[model samples]
Target: MKKISILVTAILALVFNACSTDDEFTFVAKPDPEGIAFMNTFLPSYILKPSNATNLAERFVWNEVDMDVQTTVRYELQASADESFQNMTVIESDIATTNQAVTVGELLALAEEAGLDTDPDTEASNSGTVYFQVRAYAGENPATTVEQFSEPVGITVELVEDTSGEVELPKIYVVGNFQGAGGYGSDWTPADGVPLAASGPAKTDYEGFVYLNVDKPQFKFLPTNASFDGDYGDAGETDGVFTGKLKQEGEKNAGTPDGTGGYYWFKVDTEKMTYSLTKVDWGLIGNATPTGWDSDTDLVYNPETKLWTLTLELTEQVAPDNGIKFRANDGWDINLGDTGADGTLEFGGDNIGVPESGNYTVTMDLSNPRDYTYTLVKN
Candidate 1:
């Protein structure tokens, strides 16, 4: 009986070892994808924003990338101002598809999104180039395989002015006793005040940063550039709410700040007849900033220059990508970045990249809302 049991155990052990040996794994090599080609030809170098049909600009075609494996191959086209494709928008369907076409309207929107000013009325508005590249990958949706990118191709895009006769709104300026005798209110004249420019595309919204040095018991808005002919008031109220004549008529009263003296950002809406004053607290944040994309570092505001300033030393190890952005009140709701990568700051623009790692004296000029500039001086 013992010999029979031993024979059975020996037989089972031999079967297990045979199965394990057969299961040993071996790798299969798959060749990388190659020979990606753009099939579409004669792409328009420059195009105007399309108003109607027949304006479809270009159809991007590329030869299907071939890998040794026989699975599904997906393609994606991306466009960006930066050739590195650090920040890009997918040109065609985000899904696994090929042969994408862009219409004039679509191209214009992409141009604007890429930071080229599309406002034809502005003197700074101009045409610019955008970079494009195609990427091929294999596998299922949300592909896990490595992607191969084709060489980037660039094309120039032109911005067409809007001939729609957009309404031009009056610029608002603020003047008060808080500005002091020789400051914004020197000689008690209405012309000596801080000009409030339009916030964005809205015609009736105005905003600006001002210093209320003295205990400002009163302040008023001038509709004209430097005239008091048409102004606004708070109906003799000491609250932040503003009323009175936005243009050259009506009679309300003057408005006052909630507190006596401090740096403040005033936003007034002529269409809504409303106004708000928030204490300005600007900070820096981003992957390239000293705070490392998470925290905010305060920027000092110079009353005389009306600019936010910050001087800091940056290193390549920490700020590998030379990127930073300005955010107000330690929040992302109100932030500014370089749209054109041309030192001009725009709201919610691209990340501002530093030329090199060094001590930089950064200055943000908000004096002109229509034309904001950020100057970086390396020392």
Candidate 2:
């Protein structure tokens, strides 16, 4: 019986040893605290409030995450006029919060307490440009571990004019769209010489205007003379002299000899001060049709109008027959007027004028018949 007991015990010992040897264990490596994984920790995207206002404060909010271990988070908001964020002034720094998540309004209030502007409803005392950015911290070592930084946002405060004792003149000139003139030809010279005293009688046209400043009665061109060729006579009159005079304030008529090559010239005198001259072809004004027509297409300066009228003719019959369309650089649809006979359409709008001095495109739909494009530019 004792021998048998010993054998059973030996078998039990062998079984225990086999079980121990067959059992396997595994372990996961701990994340490196000072490695790139620490620097690449995830953070929430941020948004700013009062995006369009001059006097505005910033606010922020973040996503919430739950972990088995307790974690601490702090925030630092920085601002500067530059994008690099170097030497940025700290708007709010080391804002302590134990909460895993916070609302944007609460964050803004906290920022206010930390000496940030806070009052987005309030107007700025002065007008200028401002930029902003923010950095978030996770873990106990808030000083060195920044989870992420937000993209910068910028705002410009426009300056208000104080038009008290000052006289406001027309901001721009409308000089094209002449009635009895052709393309004004490709090569013409702009007349340049000393202003002749109101010779004989003063003349006037829809194209030119005079400004009388009493102290400086002079005429300035919308675009400088350097913009156009220096020729001012009939198309063929390379030698004929064109003459006109400035009578009063806004009157001046210069005559051009009648001919295919006849051109015209005039001078602007400002008592003793400096002045300039500008010219525009009348035929080049107004909106063009799908005929590929364009104003200033010849590289000439054409006056712009707050109102533009376009005429479209459709010779083909198609459902929703493609037509010309005008769009701002921002891709906003401009107003298109009514359609006349045979797909003829018109478009007009106020404040539809180009806001800046640059090149603009007018698109024509070639999917239909007689389709083309025209481009206009302002100098």
Candidate 3:
């Protein structure tokens, strides 16, 4: 019995020892990591230019792609003029809370809404160059964060000086009867006789020939003739007319009569203006056929006297369905008459015949009137 008891005790001791050893060498499960291993970063690739003369409405863009991470991501947009971003001014500290993926355009829009000037000029005013950086944070932990930065974008701001004082604005005058015979020429008068003066209201015995002055010699023919009916008419087709004549100070005596008083086609002396006429297109009236009117001859410019002479041979007047007109300034269409197809006939110097058949607004950027709208059409 004593030996059996001793054997039992030994067995029990060995079992206990094995249990202790197993417990000492046991494996433990490590805490599962909460965040993802791979993350995508986004940075701006391009910077947009700013408007001239005004420091408004500029933008920058960035793009970010989310890695199928489990944790939500937060984005921060930081900006600086310096690459180092040492003084790193934050144009947009907290832009928005976006999904794992976001577009730079959206971020830029946010920046704009946050009242940050993305314009290069505005940025340059504060700093020479602009830089952008984006950082993604995994929840509140810095350990699971990634950052990206963009290249340095810089702009050179120029201070524009006003040199307009060198050339003074010439005096402008409007010398035509708004209410005259409204065709091409009926009761038209030469602006040459009209001295340089401030622009104002004027009238004429004829129906629709009102003229306004530009800093340079310019005039506009309004359609106001009874026979006009706002449609195309010839020089001699109807009583109402709108025509321009150029005569020198003493050439009035030699003026040729075309049913109007004592004026020929108008002349512009380049010597007085310092610029020679290279091209001339009278705004065609109505939707005239065959386009332009018959030329007497190509108007010749006298460089010495700066005078344009109407010495060309006048052809048998073949009036277009529309009369050619002029604005107070060169290159601008005459806006005095109606501007719509029904209101006024459309005319354009760039009009082509046939397949491109349509009326076009005569667009001209005149130095005189800021905006001059006119039309040309094919009859």
- Best TM-score goes to which candidate? 1
Cα error, candidate 1, residue 273 (Å): 1.9
Ranking by TM-score: 1, 3, 2
Candidate 2 residue runs with Cα over 4 Å from true position: 1-69, 96-128, 139-144, 159-379
**Model 1, 229-260: lDDT tens per residue?**
54677643334334433332344445444545
Each prediction's Cα RMSD? Answer: 25.1, 28.7, 31.0
TM-scores for all predictions = 0.49, 0.20, 0.21
Residues 1-379, candidate 3, lDDT per residue (tens digit)? 0000000000000001111365664222221234212223322222322112111223333344343344444455554433455654343343344322222232233233333442334432211223445544433434434333323333222222223322211122223332132222323343332222112111111111112211112232212222211111112222322322322221111111232331122322211311111223233222322334332112233322222233111112222334333322233433233233232323343322221433433322121321223323223
What is the lDDT for 281 in model 2?
21
Best by lDDT: 1
Candidate 1 regions exceeding 4 Å error are: 1-169, 185-188, 199-202, 236-257, 316-322
| lDDT score of residue 51 within candidate 1 | 34
Winner on lDDT between 1 and 3 is 1
Which TM-score value belongs to model 1? 0.49
Please write out the lDDT profile of model 2 over residues 1-379, one tens digit for every residue. Answer: 0000000000000001111345653222222232211112222222322211111222333332222123444555555433444544554555553212222322332223223342334443223333344444544432433254333334332222222532221111212222213222111222321112222111111122221112211222222223322112212222222233222223332223221121122243322222233222212222332242232222222222212223333222212333233432212232222243232323332212223333344322211111112333332
